[model samples]
Target: MLKRIWTIFIRDLTVNMREFMTLYMIIIPLVLAVGINFLSPSINDTSVNLALIENENPEQAAYFDDFANVELFSDEQKVEDRVMSRDSVAGILPKDNGYYIMTQGNEPESVLEYAKLLNVLYEADVQLEDARSEIIEFGRTVPPLKKMLVNMLLLLISMLAGMLIAMNILEEKVDQTVSAINVTPTSRSAFILGKSLTGMAVALFSSIACLLITGFYNVNLGQAALVVFSSTILSLLIGFIQGLNSDDVMEAAGSVKLMFLPMAGSIAGYEFVTGNWQIFFYWSPFYWAYKANDMILSKSGTWPQLILFIGIILAICGAVYALLAPRIARKLQ
Candidate 1:
């Protein structure tokens, strides 16, 4: 039985490698993750082009010392014009403590950081007036960079798992190998496991590629591997389930994407934006998986918690696999 399963897994993996599109699906997320990381310079290095609408009580531009290129504007119209022309990221309003953000599109993380900087400067302005010696607390109150980085990692990981597994199964269906494998001694569960294992392999390789490319030396390989492993299984389970209703690869891809829309949204803003939205995270497997991976990588979790989280992930994947197995069997028949 083990030999037969190994054969099945090997065949699936071999087929996945030969498919030209397989290379695209496997590497695209890595590029997105690495590209986003590389192209966008670190927040610390990026300049904040700012404009100040000199307030009635404002001193003659002596306070704005920390940021890059703080320009002076006489009125709201000038500030608005500068922002509309993409001249600056932020503007100090005519009123004290009021800052105007230029635009909300393109790299929300960048925009939010700029907002925090402006807010910090505003707080200092307030303190200087009151003759208080308080140090302005700003960026620390926002989500930490470490948390945001973890969140990005989890999103990319989940996406990698979901796309690699789901799409590969669809490719099998398209090439008619899924039906051929059905003639083997492969039980539906065993067959699913085989393909799931292949997906896990692809996801792990992607992670390694990320490590190699970025030299992110700090990853807790053991825990990260576990998370990727579990996530790949779930992705494979979803693929098998969606394949039942899809006669071709494209339909299967669409079905899988539709299935994971909720998860996708959670991936976009899980910890950074919706960390406190407990009710929102309830339906998202990505959220729980992210939490589990986070704990493992950060060393913030007890062993039991890791076990419990992995167990729950396995259980959820198992329950889903079990329910979908019969349906898949019926569909194949």
Candidate 2:
């Protein structure tokens, strides 16, 4: 059985390599991972340009300068104009005994930065010396860069496996290989397993390569692999369904792009959102994978939690397979 499966896997992989698009798809994850790493420094950086009314106190100007580019305007009106026009995130207007913070209700990060600045300004005696002493408390808070990087990796890995597996199966259907394979000793179960294993192999390899290239120093390799593996199952199931519906590669490709819409929901809901709004996205199986990967990358994911995620993914995969397998098998007949 192992030998038969291996033969099928090898043949499928070899055939895929001969196709330019398929080969490129296999390397997409690695290429993207490298690109994201090169851009990580900028992505993690939080620097804002600030405009301040030209005040007589060089002390106030110098204090704000430490955190951001402190631009001096001719007057309060110019400063207010800059803030209102969104030329800068916020402006500072020094007043008697205190400061007035001018901000637009826009970016959240800018608001947070403003609040921190407010704290520093409030505590300071409006003296440069005192402000300088207090400035040490303010430091750059790096966002969860690793979680984001891992999220992209998971997304690409799933996409790679999903699209390729669907394409592969669809290609076989188009070539009429399914009819021949069906008549042979290969059971439907074995045929499905072989295709799934092919996807898993490609996904696992691409994911590991992505992590290694992007500096897997702080990563839990075992857990990352498990997450990638589990996530690939969902993608493969999607691919299977797409392949079953598609008559050709172009149709499959077009349909796969639409698949990313729900994927975007999976990412946005899990990462950018909170509260009751998040529950709406739990229906997406990919979200469980995203959640698990996020927790695993944070190194806070327990075995029980990992198992729960894997179980949910497996249940979804099983349900999808049960629903689609018979319909797909009939197609070959």
Candidate 3:
């Protein structure tokens, strides 16, 4: 049966090669989103046309340097006018000891976007200063700041790969291939493995290729690889299962939007984007994947933690597959 499934896997590849649809489903993403992510310009220019106030202190000015392109304006009104005219992205104005971020919009609201970042940086500088003073200069290496980088990877990974797997399966279903293979004696287990392998192969290959092209970033090799692969396969399998549940290709593709929020939100913890506990995220495979990825990328986790992270996802995938196999078999009957 395993041999047969392997043969079927090869057959799937041949069929995939011959079909422009399958090729398009996988190749288009690689050439587009993933390609663009690596090729796009960096956001290094945090500089903004910022205007400071009369009561500005050196401490505040230091903060602005971290997040904005600081340009001084004499009055808050001038800053407001520039913002209203769309001449500037944001403006910093003075109030008392601190300043207020005045933004110009039809709603006449304040956009502390850049200002808030500056404030955070300034506060960080102050905290660091205090720490330095307190430590009596206790020699310590500053930990590498890996920003919400982990979240971005998880969001991109699960969504992209999940959408692909789901869409591909939905396409196969729409084409009546799922119905065609319903009569196979090798069982639904074999059939699913065959399809799962197809999607996994695409995701795994694309991920590795993308990483290779961009050059590896701040991630531990063995731990990260294991975590990423496990999570990716689980995500792909879940996506495939969801795609199979769809009645048609368009329906399946549209379903990707439904999965987006959960997948992206689930990774919020990986990047610490929101302190709000997304309870729904607990159920998302991508969340676990993101958590696991965080360990590898940050190199802050122990071996047991890494194992549990990767291992649990694999177990979940196995469980989901087992549960699905019986249902698929009954449907075949």
lDDT of 3 by residue, 1-333 (tens): 787678667776677667676667567545654544544423342245566654556567655655456665666676666677744456666567655666654421233565666665565665444543333533211122322343354446545566666765666676777666766666776876776666666666665554444334544555655665677665665576668688866676676657667666665544565546645466666777777665554556799988876777788778876877665455434
Quick one: RMSD of model 3? 7.8
TM-score of 1: 0.64
In angstroms, give how far residue 45 of model 2 lies from its true place.
7.3
- Best by the lDDT measure: 2
Give me the runs in candidate 3 sitting further than 4 Å from their true place: 17-21, 28-155, 175-185, 273-280, 315-325
Query: What is the Cα-based TM-score of model 2?
Result: 0.71
Among these predicted structures, which one has the highest TM-score?
2
Worst 10 residues of 3 by lDDT: 138-147
Error of 3 at 58 (Å): 27
lDDT tens per residue, model 2, 41-135? 43335566677767655766776677577788998888877878733467767778766677775746755476466536645545546544534
Candidate 2, residue 196: the lDDT equals 82
- Model 1 ranges with Cα > 4 A deviation: 39-153, 171-190, 211-215, 272-277, 296-299
Candidate 1 or 2, higher TM-score? 2
Candidate 2 residue spans exceeding 4 A from truth:
42-142
- Give the per-residue Cα lDDT of candidate 3 at 118: 63
